[model samples]
Target chain A: MTNPTAAMLVIGDEILSGRTRDANMHHLAGELTKQGVDLKEVRVVSDEADAIVAAVKALSDAYDHVFTSGGIGPTHDDITADCIARAFGVGIDVRDDARALLERHYESTGLELNPARLRMARIPDGARLIDNPVSTAPGFTLGNVHVMAGVPLVFQAMVASVVPTLTGGAPLLSQTLRVNRGEGDIAAVLSQLAADFADLSIGCYPFQVNGAFGANVVVRGTDGGRIDAAVTRLAGELGL
Target chain B: MTNPTAAMLVIGDEILSGRTRDANMHHLAGELTKQGVDLKEVRVVSDEADAIVAAVKALSDAYDHVFTSGGIGPTHDDITADCIARAFGVGIDVRDDARALLERHYESTGLELNPARLRMARIPDGARLIDNPVSTAPGFTLGNVHVMAGVPLVFQAMVASVVPTLTGGAPLLSQTLRVNRGEGDIAAVLSQLAADFADLSIGCYPFQVNGAFGANVVVRGTDGGRIDAAVTRLAGELGL
Candidate 1:
């Protein structure tokens, strides 16, 4: 069977404008890897309704699971929930469960909940809510796409709430060997070694140390035995 | 004047596997912002030739500049150069200038340059090489797209070499204020304030502190006066 595939869509102008260096993608990638879900793709787009709808439809169709962060706020640009609803061809209305959650949250704070805040209570039909203990506004899973808040903290909290319920495959196995040599020095042997181990992925990440070149060879695979074999072969090829 | 839009295409499987959290996006975003270039989008695709080609064409047409990271290595999966050439409907050949650079780099290191290592010397017709002082494999700019290596250090070096050549608008100005209050508490007023300020973008980012909810409000714009005014009004509304 093919590995379970997932994609992340970071929808926010804050991220795109360089105002926010996104933590959502890194956090989601790590969490998904631990759960054995293969994160195949990630796209960070501005909070445009058309762009969000198009990306949502395309990614939802391509992957088994799609996680979207950002644009789910009370602000005008927070159109992710509505755009996602439109993508699914479903009607969006303020749901009782969502309103109840928002109401309880506001009741405790002694702040009168305005209609704008109630916008967070809007839910697409046939969607299940993901609890957010950190904030009142809940994230929801509609069809294959999971829509969460733009804020990293809120997004992470919602992800933690949702991840436990997912059925996962075998955990991804990986090994890394740091090499002091430049990538060019190890290019030939590394290519041949990579070709020999077709099942494992060999990635060469170069770094600079004191204005000199260095690289790290990372070998990853679902099977531990295959990953180990690849790493061993790579090390031998490097004459380590 | 319209904001100078830019997009980034990150080509790698290591990122998807969660082994590497990309540092280049944040770096580039911050750099572009200072240069008055708006980084509008970012897409991370695997080292698939077709995917790279398609993304290059799509993003290049849509934005003023397309910055790509990764898949510029000498390994088999490093198909970005060829894919980019194909995307632009051009032919790639080993150029004397690139070959000279590679030859010099190899001679300085006293390493025997194999045929596979020389693959880095291949350049597409009509492309300009972007300097990579850290590594011999130089990135290049073809049309509006700038293709660089995945390695953070080398990628940064290439970006430094190329960014100053591009035309940009006014630098985006931003002011951030942190409030030890939940986003939900200030969601309504923030939304209204955002509507009132047509020029400034008000972004609400929530944070978690010792299991308590808090948020940071960031106001961004090209006009420093407008950003300051929005921030002042927001702070007053929040009673901070």
Candidate 2:
């Protein structure tokens, strides 16, 4: 049986403005794929409460898991925690557990946990904190919606901490074969072969080689033997 | 005056699965930014029709313009055109204008425009074609939704054709100062300065430098004078 699917909601105005090139989507995609949890969708929204609430509710219902990144920072724009709380129809406040974590960090760092900073401690009720080794601000998992940080280092660390604890399906396996041919040149034959291998997903990624275009044929599947066989057949047919 | 805000809807399963790293979002963001339009959100949904319809409707109503990439292809999975039509409560069929373009291309290339290929010609009623110079398949603009090809080359060409036709506002001006400072060391000052520049957006992008984290600070604003002032103040504050 195929593993359960997941989605990602990247919330930030900075991302859309091209002020921030997102690293969270790429990280989550690679991580989820490794865990056999197929990332089925990804949405990047602004810091608006309505947008965040709408996307969170919609995606959480569609996929088995929904991991959100950004807008959970200490700044005034950080409204993801509150928006998520509302989406889940739950009340949120500064939790003792989260506040303690922030308090300890500020004490050690000798930095005051100001009102803006304290905003990070307001997690939705019933949500469990995901450990953040990079920073004291804790990420929380509310049902299937995993709320995380926007900063790449902190987000990656939090993801690493949370992913290991969840149940994973069969790991996804992939192999890439570089074909010094264009997609149009190999489409017909490759399409037929792709149809034959029903279980495996074959994707042709085109890249420029010299002045011409070439394709890197990638075969992905849970079954190692099937993937190997498909690669072999592909290489043989392409005369590589 | 600010250019109206826009959002991108990337309709593809390939992106979510990490089979394809999305080029559309980057391309659209840069293009819109240059045209003085602020891209506010981006959503990457699967090929599922329902998901596509929901995303299209929601995004169209929210933004001044909605740009959709992917799903307009000559394959079974290419369902973007139909979905957009459905979302608009419109009917989709093979339009004469689209068929003419495809017919011309087929005649020139001496390739049969098969039924599968003709699927590319099917477009929503009352839609204007967004020409594809690189490929024969034409994208179309209906209402506020500009449905474009998923292929990067085709998508870029379509965007080039569409951007010049749209009205725009004041373009965002930005300047970057590459620094060899760690974010942690500069956090307090940077945070304070960022708070001061309400109209300007300051983003700290960290990179690994000699096994240490170093960041390049970027300041963005619609007013060139404000951006320069912010940068000057930031430099003075950071003692750079």
DockQ of predicted model 1:
0.60
In the order shown, what is each candidate's alpha-carbon RMSD? Answer: 2.1, 4.0
Q: What TM-scores do the predictions have?
A: 0.94, 0.82
| Overall local distance difference test of candidate 2 | 0.82
Candidate 1, A184: how far from true, in Å? 1.5
Candidate 1 ranges with C-alpha deviation above 4 Å? A109-111
Docking class of 1: medium
Every model's DockQ:
0.60, 0.35
Task: For residues B1-240, write the lDDT of model 2, one tens digit per residue.
Answer: 667989899986667776667877877888888898989889888777998998899889988999998878665456789998899899999999899999998789776777767878999999988888987689999999999977788788999999877798888778998767655456566678778998877766555655555666778888999889888887887788
What are the lDDT figures for the candidates, one per model?
0.85, 0.82
